[model samples]
Structures are given as C-alpha cells and as structure tokens.
Target: MYFTFRQVQYFVLTAELGTISGAATAARISQSAITESIRQLEEQVGSALFSRHARGIALTYEGHRFLRHAKLIISTVKDAEDAFTAKNDNVAGNLRLGVTNLVAGYFLSDILARFRRVFPEVSVEVVEDHRRYIEHLLISGELQLALMVISNIEEQFALSVDPLMRSRFRVWVSPKNDLADKSRVKSSDLRDQKLILLANEDLLESISGWLQGEELIDQVFLRTTSVEAVRSLVGTNTGVAIMPDLAFRPYTLEGDRLEARPVEGLSVTLDVGLVWRQGSPDTDQAEIFKTVARDYHSKR
Candidate 1:
C-alpha cells in the first residue's frame, strides 16, 4: 500500500549490486525476500525498475531516473539520524580526510572532484599515509574519516568501516611476457618469474601471504613504494607485479601496453571504503562526504 524505507533500501541495493542475490548477500537478507521487495516496489511505483538478463539485472530508463530520488531519500534519512547522534556541524566546515597511498593515487580524485562540485563550500584537507598510519590518525581524532583498504583492518571493532568496492589482486605483466598470451595465470606460473612488489605493507603482506602457499615470496626482484614504478617495471617486461583492480592499468606512462590475468588460486580481496571512530560523532560534513563517495562508487 505504501513505499516503505525498507523497500527503498532494497531497490537501491539491487541497483548498486545489479542482482538480487548480490543485494541479499550484501544486506544480509534472503534472495526471495529481496525479489518480493523489488516486486512490491515496482508495483507501487507502477513501473518496471530493472530489465532481467541471463547474467544479472540492469536499470531501465525509468529506473535510472528513479535512482536519484532513492539515493536522496536514503541520504537525507541517514543525515537526519546522524544529526541526533552526532555533532551537527554545518556543511560548510573543514573536512579532515585521511587517505591511503593506493587510494589517493587510484580513487581519491574522482571522489574529491564530485564532492567538491556538490559541496564547494566545504574545505577539504587530505593526509596521505600507509593504511596503519591512516587508521592511527582516525583513532587519534586527527582525521574526521578515512578512505583506505578495510579488508584486513587490525582494529575493526574500534572503527565503523563501510566498504565501497571489492578489489581483488591479479597478475600484471607486459604484453611481451611469456605468460601474457595465456588465458589464465597461476601461482606456480609466477614462482619462477621476477616479481615487482608494491611497498605498501598491507598489500605486501596480502600478496606475500597468498604466494607463500607456493613458497614463492622470495621471487621478488624489485620493491618500490610507488605504484607507477610497479607499472613501469611491468610495462617494460622487467618484472611482473601483482596488484588489485583499483590500481591496475593496461598501460604505463611510456604508452607500452600491459595485461592483467586472474591468479588461479588466490582469494584475497581489498575492500576499500570510509572509516571513522566507532564511538566518535561524525560531523555533518563527514556524513555528506560519505554520501558523495558512495554515489561515486555506485556509479562505477
């Protein structure tokens, strides 16, 4: 009889994840229940929101138009909740942002640009650091919020982590590499090849933990803190690097082409998102910025 907040949330999650099952898993609901919610939502709205495909679902023209309203509703309601529990700082205040090196290079610009366009009056200061250091800043109240890898956070219970995207690491190689032409690459395949490792400790640890199964952590040829350096090495066929989709590119600065293929047996995922102290009150500015980040990630 009415469009409830639960229906709106279900609709938005389905649109974001592009499947009922995905929405279910992400929201900790059942697939049938999600389906029924979408069905009731469509009935109440008097339009088909999604076009079903063999693989997944896609928003219809009307669905795309409605998505804006859904996000606005969700964000507005969440902001209202934040107002009661958190400091009601005006949207015009300065936002202290902590970003990790990997996120700063790969994902921060787009989020910052869109956020600036929407909240131009909000001043933003970003501190780029390692994941642990960023978390430290978040914990110490130096940062209002942070965008970083949340997959393996040491103190997860102390922070509120909202994941924006899942980035799984894979092998990156120059087109000239011997395995470049193969349909798939495996851990054993990379054991003998030269490896260029990113110097980010968390990433280094994730990559090492997986490759340790093959006893191949010692295969590293060069280690650098710069993602571009890893790219250059892989592009020039100097060494193969393993990195997540967030920072992986098919080309280097010199315009040399590269390739990325999934590792046959690796299951590590880098989930990046916003984090703040669990007990700390979020500023209004932080709430709005989080909305901007979510919208950007949803579109991608």
Candidate 2:
C-alpha cells in the first residue's frame, strides 16, 4: 500500500522536529495521532524512519534519504497551491511569453519593467525567437502571448491581433553617401544600390507589389537578412538597407555615420501588434500587460 500525503507530512514533521510531541504541536494534532501516522508511513514504506534517542527521535539513514524526496513533493504541492491562489486572486504568477528579437529590442523592456513594478510577484519567462516560429509557438499554446511582426501574419489562422503601432521602413545608408542629399529617392534610383532586408518576407513582397504598381521592379538589388550586417555594411558604404523606423532610431550607427530617409513615391508601412490565441480566459496579469502596452503606445 502507498503512504498517504498526511502520513508523509507526519513523517517529515517528525524528522524535522526530532520528536513526536514537537511534530504534533507544530501540526496542531495530538501526539498520539502524529505517532500513529508516522508508524503507518513506516509500515507502508517497509523501513524504520526514526530511532529513539536520549530525549527525542533521530532519523535512520533511510529516513534522511527519503526526507529529500518528501521535501520536494511538499514543495511542489505548495507551489501549485500558491500558483492557483495567485492566478485567481492576484495578478502574480508565472507567465510564459514569446517575443521576437525585433520586438524585444524595441518595446518589451519598458512593458516588462512597468509590469514588474506593479506586480512584483509575477514571474516572467521570455522566449526570443524569429517572428515566424514565435507565432507558431503562440498558436500551439506553448506561449501565453507574443510580440510579433504583424506584417508577416497569415490571414488563414484564427488569432486575436491587436495593432500596437504603425511604422514604415526607411532606406539606411552612410550619411556621407550621395543619396543623403536627396529629399526623396525614386524607385529607379535604387537600381545600383545593394540592399539588405530583414525577415518578414510578406512585407518584402508587399513592398515589391508597391514597386510593381509603380512599375519599378527591375531596379532591385541585393537582399541580406542580418540587421547588424546591414548596419555594418551600410556604415562601411557597402550598401543601403530598409529597416523599421522604430528599430532604426535616430538613423545613426555607432556614430553619425548612417542616415535613413524615405524613398520618394513609396508609401509602405507595417502595423505591429500583440497576438494571442482567441477564447483564452482573461487573467488579471494578461489585462495588466494589455493595459501597459496600450498606455505605452498611446503616449507614443
């Protein structure tokens, strides 16, 4: 037969207090009941847990070994109870969040910091992945929420997407490059400039569509993925790149070496949003996060 939780509790208490009377006192039970429970536990385990000493009980070697596992079980149970209580009544529990590097680099820090300030007990785990993988994980229930590139979202999936901000890509180049002097660059002006593009192929396709609509497709150049690579390449005058305005910030890299300007006759913008699975129960923590994001965007 297996030992009951109460029996394990009694045994652990007896081991800790080193006396049946002390264990009973701490557990608010009678000494006889504590002793009987410990006895039953010993019988179930088929081993002696305590040995009588001069004034109290001492653990046998087996008891010390069993004590560790018992403590783990107790701790796990307590943690579950605490998590349940916090989820139901407090905006404090474990949150599994996913964020793309782009999103985390730009927006997540402020939102998380504000959240920590308000709900100090809430534990947050952030998984940073590319936008595509992060979105897949979020839909699979592996993540509670995610900050992703809505420009890359597929319309076939049923997801609750909330637009947080709208931003456009600006072509970045060395400030000293010839293009820096132009008020606006035409689509055909990029014919000779090497180009770098970030992930989110759909956005790139949208840009292509815009270019095609304006009858300017054959003028395209090289496309690279790494934003850092783009920055380095542009800093060294290797090529120009298109990056989100919020992501590019101040249009300088390591110094006032790089500049970003709008290309003329092109009106391409992407909406970034918060995505979560539909029909999930709204927790206070989720609400807190939502409010923080909305308020943060409203101020910007």
Candidate 3:
C-alpha cells in the first residue's frame, strides 16, 4: 500500500487531535479534506484507523500501531530536511546557552544535534541548572540563550520567550496498576495512592498547586531527581506518577511497560521554548541557532 507524506501527516494530526474537524482546523484545511485524506489512507492500509463516536474519534488498535510508524516517518523526513538545510549555511561561532535539568534531558539534545550538524564550526557551551538559575544566566548576559520550561518563568518582563511546544500533564502508572485501565484519572483518584514526584522545582510547584489538601500531600511516597528512577519505580508498581507527557515513555529501561492517561481536571500544560534577554542584540550564531530550533519544533 502506497501513501504520500501528506497522508501520513494528516493521519498523525487527526490521531493527536482526536477529531477530523480539529485536525482540519489545525492544518488550516477544510474538514472534507481531512475526511477524504483519512478515507484514502484507510483504504491504502486496508483497515480503519479511528473509531467514530458522538464527541469525536478514538484510535483503533491498528490506529495505535500505525501512529508510531507515522510519527517515525515524520521525524525521519524532518531530520533529512534539517541536514540538507544545515549544509547550505556555513555560519559558525561560539554559542553560550543555558538549560534546566528537565529540558536538557528531554528536549535540548535533538535541537543541539541538528544545530551542530548545520554549523559544525560553532562551539556550543551549555550550562545546566535550575530554571531560576538559567534565567539569571540569561539576564546577566552570561548565556546567549536558554531552553527551559517557560510556564513558570518569574522574570517574564525581563526576557523574551519564544515558545516551541506545550505538553500536558498526565498520570503514569504500571500496566499492573488499576489506573492503567482508566481513560481519565482524576486528581481525587490519586489522593490515597502512593505518588512518586520528580524533584524539579518548577514541576514540584505546579504539582503541589494541583494536588492541594492535606490528604493528597500526605500521599507522597518519595521524591527523586532522576526521571529514569521515576519510570522504574512506577514500572515496578512502587508508586504511580503525574508528569508532563513530553518526558513520558511507554517502557522502562528494564523493559517493563508503563501507561499514561489524561488527568480529568488538569488543564495546565508545560511550555518549553527559547528565552533571551529582551533588548540584547542577537549575534550571528545565536540567531542561527534560534532559527534552527524553532524550525525543527514547528515541523514536529
């Protein structure tokens, strides 16, 4: 079965938005266009990708399987384009950047890799620290740019934020846990459950706000600074966790499966992107890096 790149893009978008209309709106095309694209894609694959419902649609088992392949195809195509585009630009210089611990691990690596490929002569120095410290580095002119979670940035008036992506918080559980079967786990559902919290200051503050009340706070089992530790502990059913979907993985390092489900009353999302001093003149290297990072995320 043959399908164009556009078809795969449409399928992935529709799967993510969970509705043809929403995908069409996001893609800036008509709903009929999205429907036809999905219909042709389903014909090509010889299976229904989504199940229609009153509110919207849900991915079928086949759709879930196909979504993974679709995302890989998109990422592969974007990488190729990035590599080709980078070869055309020869701008190079030292770029001093700052990053928080969470953003460094989850988001910065891919952007840095693409940037280096494009500007091989550029020396990239990264300082990893807490979000507040990263912001301080940016403000003090010690860093040219910072990639961090911008949702809780304190000195917003002093910095310019260029947002790349926003990821929602979700409840993560082991497949053996009862919450794994839930379509949406409410905050109240976690009141009595043992909870594993990540030790990032920003995440801790947000979670603390959401999980208010003595009963919920008292349910905290342990707090750690390692993302992998949270994954492993949750995978072994030691405790479930609520974290940003951006850092989520289906399986632990030890090969145990984990599941993420939507939180019913959670409307907060983690915004990650680039931040720079408001009036600082952009150097050639800093400008190029920012462009590359923004383009990379926009494609994704």
Candidate 4:
C-alpha cells in the first residue's frame, strides 16, 4: 500500500527481464537493490509475484495480474506529468502524417493519442502505406512527418530521423512448444521449425538479412501481413515467429499464450522513429509533435 513509484518501476523492469541481475544492470543499480524493490512490492501487494528458479524468476499468477496494473500506473503517471507541463492549449493547426503498416498498428496509436491530448485543437490526417510510398510522400512534401521503421530507410540521406525506440527481435513460440522453455533460441534451432513470417517488406528484409544462411527459407510455412494472424498461429502451436519485441503480446485474441525468447545470434533491432525531409523547413506543427514524441519516449 505504501510502495513508491521507484519500487513499481523496479518491479516492472525485474518482471520484464526475469532476473534481478538483468534488471539491476538495466536500471544501473545493484542486484540486491532490485531484489529489495521486488520484495517490497510483493509485500505491499500481499502476494508472491514471482516463482524463483535456478535460471531466473517467472511471474506468479498474481504477478501477471499485477503487471497490467503496474504498467497502467506508470502510464497514468506519465500522462499526468505531461498534462501538467503542457503549454500548447492555444496551439491549433492541421498536420499531415505518414506511417508504415507495422508502425501504424503498434507504435502510432499511443503517440497519436498523447499528441491529440496535448493539442486537441489540431486536426490530424494520417496516411498508412508501405514504407517506400511513405518515403515518397515525405520527399514530395505531401507529408510533413512520418512515423516509421527507420532501420532500413531507403532515403536516409534525404531525410532527418529521430529514433524513438529500438526493439530487438525475439522468437515467439506457443506456451506449449518445446522452444518456449528455452532461455535463448538460436537460428539453427529454427532451421527445421515451421515459421510464420510477417509479410511487410521492411520486416521481411530485416529478418531475412539476419537469418540468412540459417536454412530457414525452406522452413517458412506461412507468410502474412497480419500481426494477429502470426500471433494466433504462433499461439496455437502452428509455427514459431521471429519478430520485434515492440509488436509482442503475451496472448492471442483467442487467449492462447505466447512466449518470447531472445535469439542467440540475432543482433538486429527494429528502429522506429520520426522522419522528415532534411532540407524542408520545420513547421510549427511538426516541431510541436516532435517535442511531444521526444518527451513521450524519454519517459519510457
């Protein structure tokens, strides 16, 4: 009942990393400090949040239930802080934005929601397209700003990019799959496994580049652009998927659980960010949105 935000933050990180040492390393604190925070949080909640094992810890049922509330608490605190500091009550303008399909589904909504809340008077028009077409629109000045996967931008030199977040790729497996119990999965481990690949060109290209020479091409069982389809297939034990953590969900729409495991040899990350034409004059709307996005990602 008296736990601090720091405790909740530590709790969340510990839950995410599944190890006190990993959370400590991420938080730049001592392992004992991370342990204490989790202990205090568990005490405050009056339940055991994690089941400890030789490898690491896993969330107890109570912990999984509490994780949702903990994340909401952090989000609510961030929104409240942003609301208090916002100075754009009188700002009003129309803004044109472009987004890739993957980004539009995962990252755009939260940022757009925050932007709208901060600048309620501003009208926003969003265009969702493939990354190439979005880049064309950005270069043509048809779009003032774009939220996209900036990792493989074809026009990198022609655009100015502000990376918001980097999400590393992980192998998604059904809870019942043999790979789900593994701490880390190697590309070789997936060579014979059925794969459910996302059909987005950018994602496919990135995945292909990393997974090259792994003999996975012939193992790909299905290719679809739908993230949910991939989730469902992976959750139902149809196949495993290697995807960025940004788009990961623990459960499918049908409530089948999925697990994400780090890839041993995969070092690629999906970088999503704001992009604009390099030489174009930054409009007031663009600058304002950038500031909000910067602030939003900074807190995360």
Candidate 3 regions off by >4 Å? Answer: 1-90, 213-215
Task: Count backbone clashes in candidate 3.
Answer: 0
Which regions of candidate 1 fall more than 4 Å away from where they truly are? 1-90
After TM-score superposition, the amount by which residue 60's alpha carbon in candidate 3 deviates from its true location, in angstroms, is 16
Q: Which of the two, 2 or 4, has more TM-score?
A: 4
lDDT of each: 0.84, 0.72, 0.87, 0.87
Q: How well is each residue in 188-258 modelled by candidate 1, as lDDT tens digits?
A: 88977999888887687667777777787789878898888888889899999889998875567776777
lDDT of 2 by residue, 179-260 (tens): 8888778767776776665544545654667756755455445565566666777877777776677666332345435678
Measured by TM-score, how close is model 4 to the native structure? 0.79
How accurate locally is residue 68 in candidate 2, as Cα lDDT from 0 to 100?
A: 59
> Positional deviation of 186 in candidate 2, in angstroms?
0.8
The RMSD (Cα, Å) of candidate 1 is 9.7
Candidate 1: residue 72 lDDT (0-100): 70
Candidate 4: give the clashing pairs: none
